[model samples]
Target: MRQALLLALAALVIVSCGRRGPQPQAVEPQAFADTTPPSIIYPAFGDADPHPWEDRHPGHYPVHGLDVSRWQPPIDWRTARASGVSFAFIKATEGGDFADPKFDEHRRGAQAAGVPWGAYHYYYFCRPAHEQARWFIQNVPKGADLPHVLDMEWTPHSKTCRIRPDGRTVRAEAQKFLDILERHYGRRPIVYTTVDFYGDTDIGRLPKTEFWLRSVAGHPRNVYPRAIWRFWQYTGTGLVPGVQGKVDINTFNGTPEAWAHWKAGG
Candidate 1:
């Protein structure tokens, strides 16, 4: 009887030891250092001064960034960084089935050049929000340093989706997309909007979500009028160094220290 009891105890000990939980994986810290020196002349768009939309002075916002898509020429991220571009939002996907062909190159190049980048999806009003959200999730990788964005705008002229949904329907669709992305990425997503879309959908009342407002003609305060904005895209015809053609210029709505805190996932 004593020998049998000893064997049973030994078996139990082995079983318990074998059932240990999985070990945690190590995550490498992301680099956010800006090494671009002052006095570096960025490329110009044309003889007309490519950046003519500088309604506000550079001293107003210490942190600046840009948004890019395939329409922009191949980017020299190193030069962009040196030109004081602190971050970038790269177009990753659109609609339900369309993925940006240059997404992989842009993502890899931005990281290699030490630029913090986020992916943005161009929302299609014709498609279901859940389907578009899943498509974006499948395309963009997890654990990105910056928050994902849903670029919503009035596509009255879209060849694909010309029909505009009602304001309530638009708001519901946006909510669904935001929820799905937030759950998958473990961070709240941003809603990018134009003046027309904001007025159409009344997106300013979205609960607990940050906004990236596009008001190229004037400050968001004057254009959006009482709407809260986190990032303000001031110009779409911006000329930055290391980038050919035109690019979109944007600024964070806070000081450099505040931007650092936000970038650190605060």
Candidate 2:
């Protein structure tokens, strides 16, 4: 009886050793399939100058990116990523209460495509700065990979808010908005402005803030003289792959190494 029990125990041990534990479940292939509208092509223009700015200005900065809103069609982010798009800025909100209709979609698309993206809020001259800041914070969630931007441009011709506040008032309002966003995002927010608004509000004199300047006619040095800039929006009528129609194109001020540091939140 003892011998039989020993043989049975040895058999059980052998069976246990031979049997394999649960195998890992097969991973589903990532779905990078292009589902964008047929109107949106991988290369919007064939045998054409996709990056006119680069052609116009030879030997310019290597890193280039785009800014998009609801005005753009559904984008094939994978194609854009493969076509040399390093980063993106998605418009999230406007004024105090209005949110961009395509904000969520663009944000998600950029993330899934492994692109670093940030959000920007369009400032409304008529709205209170604190209220607009609160609205932006409520709408745009925190922990974004890129720093937030306050798009401060002239509303002189705006049908909604044409009141151009004085320089002091504008600076105060910008400071209020920047303070709120910095506290919420835990990083200094960038300020975007056109030449007219930058001059009107003296945004260059603003303390301890980087600026994204719009200089379509020429380089920022000629347009925004004596002012330091981090990003430069060179053209609004830019042609890029995976983007429908014309889009805004921008470049970083520093080398690719500096961009890596900035993108890493350092």
Candidate 3:
């Protein structure tokens, strides 16, 4: 009887201790976040070469465009065209599993509106190169109006990829993905990355690929650690006419002739 009672008491003690589960390491429930304003650099293109960029009338540019995800809805392409929007780059997919719901709608809408458009894939540094490339290719259609862009940046708040490979590994993975995309798309995909991410990963080594540099404050020269940039994303909170909330803005790097030749050559 005594031994049974002792065993029962021991089992009870063990059960109670097991329920605690490492005391949860006393983690002080990390503080939460609220709506925060994104960092703003150069708010306007007042200092850029106005002559090279064609203005809608005289002082405005003719090719201002927006890049959007599913979160941005009910795009009024007519109003956007009137407001000088000439192109768009819509989100298509990411990694090898997730796809942006906005891709089909944006593609169809833009085609119907007679606007040039492109597709972008959000890159996951941890994912296999071939898999990620396949994800993009499988989702986005062939003969797309504009070029495909590999959006490579540190998405610190990404629910899936809060962590990434080191810089050297990251670049290697990027190269592998790019090679696959180029083989399939028949043109080298554009590399879209912020200055910090570019600096961290020696992006200059990938010279064959064009870059859609994201530098909100200064020119790609001043901001990007590298020397050359083909496209520039200057704004993410732009208040265009058709876009109800904020939207991204981009600029092409070359003349109309150059654009035509490049497309033809590709």
Candidate 4:
């Protein structure tokens, strides 16, 4: 399999960041094609403040990955790949003008390390959905291994654009964004959201796309009730080698074969 070949032939390695002041340049990872993960790609990761699972744990899942942005910087992607970082969703554009500084670097590194990577846009209420979609398309390149994500969550603490539309308006806006991205990228975009937003906006009613629910305290079935999900963002305080500070950890809700089939766009 492609994943086995990449894992066996490639020796992903990196230099850990240990400085206090200016962050040093990361060792460039060797080129490797992004492919479906090997069977049972166990997550070799940790959490700063671990949540006790009363039911099925994140580790029980066969495939695991992470999401990162400017907040978790100076990552050694090679080391992360070696530590079973099967896939990654890197934050790209937000609103209209805001772009992530580390997006290009993160995407490249993840690709080179053979980690399937995609970009995500943080939904901003102020901007028009089409404008934000265009902005995201302008930034994140095509041909990402995984489908891109639209992070739809309420930002009440924002300095600008804190307005919360009703569920109908929210779903309409989300569908517009999803339609634009699906047409542009040739893959249906996934929705990443929090419990509160899911409750208020009723975005679960959004059509024809998978959901990546953030339920750190418990399983999605427990938190999201009857809603089905593809990915689960279980923790934000995750720790892994090569990545500085805490990062978001997630799990795929399927077996190795199922994950491979999904990655193949089956």
User: Which of the numbered candidates is closest to the native, going by highest TM-score?
Assistant: 4
**How much is the lDDT of residue 246 in candidate 2?**
80
Q: In angstroms, how far off is 157's CA in candidate 3?
A: 1.2
- What residue runs in model 3 are displaced by over 4 Å at the alpha carbon? 1-62, 263-266
True-structure lDDT of candidate 4: 0.84
TM-score: the better of candidates 2 and 3: 2
Ranking by lDDT: 4, 1, 2, 3
Instruction: Show the lowest summed lDDT stretch of 10 residues, model 2.
Output: 27-36
* Model 4 regions more than 4 Å off: 1-44
Prediction RMSDs, each to the true structure:
17.1, 20.8, 17.5, 20.5
TM-score of each: 0.80, 0.78, 0.74, 0.83
The TM-score measured for candidate 4 stands at: 0.83
Give per-residue CA lDDT, model 2, range 62-136, as digits (tens): 567788999999998888888878889999999987999999999999899988888999998888999999999
Assess candidate 3 and give its lDDT.
0.70
Which residue pairs in model 2 clash with each other? Answer: none
User: Best-fitting candidate, measured by lDDT?
Assistant: 4
lDDT per model vs. reference: 0.80, 0.78, 0.70, 0.84
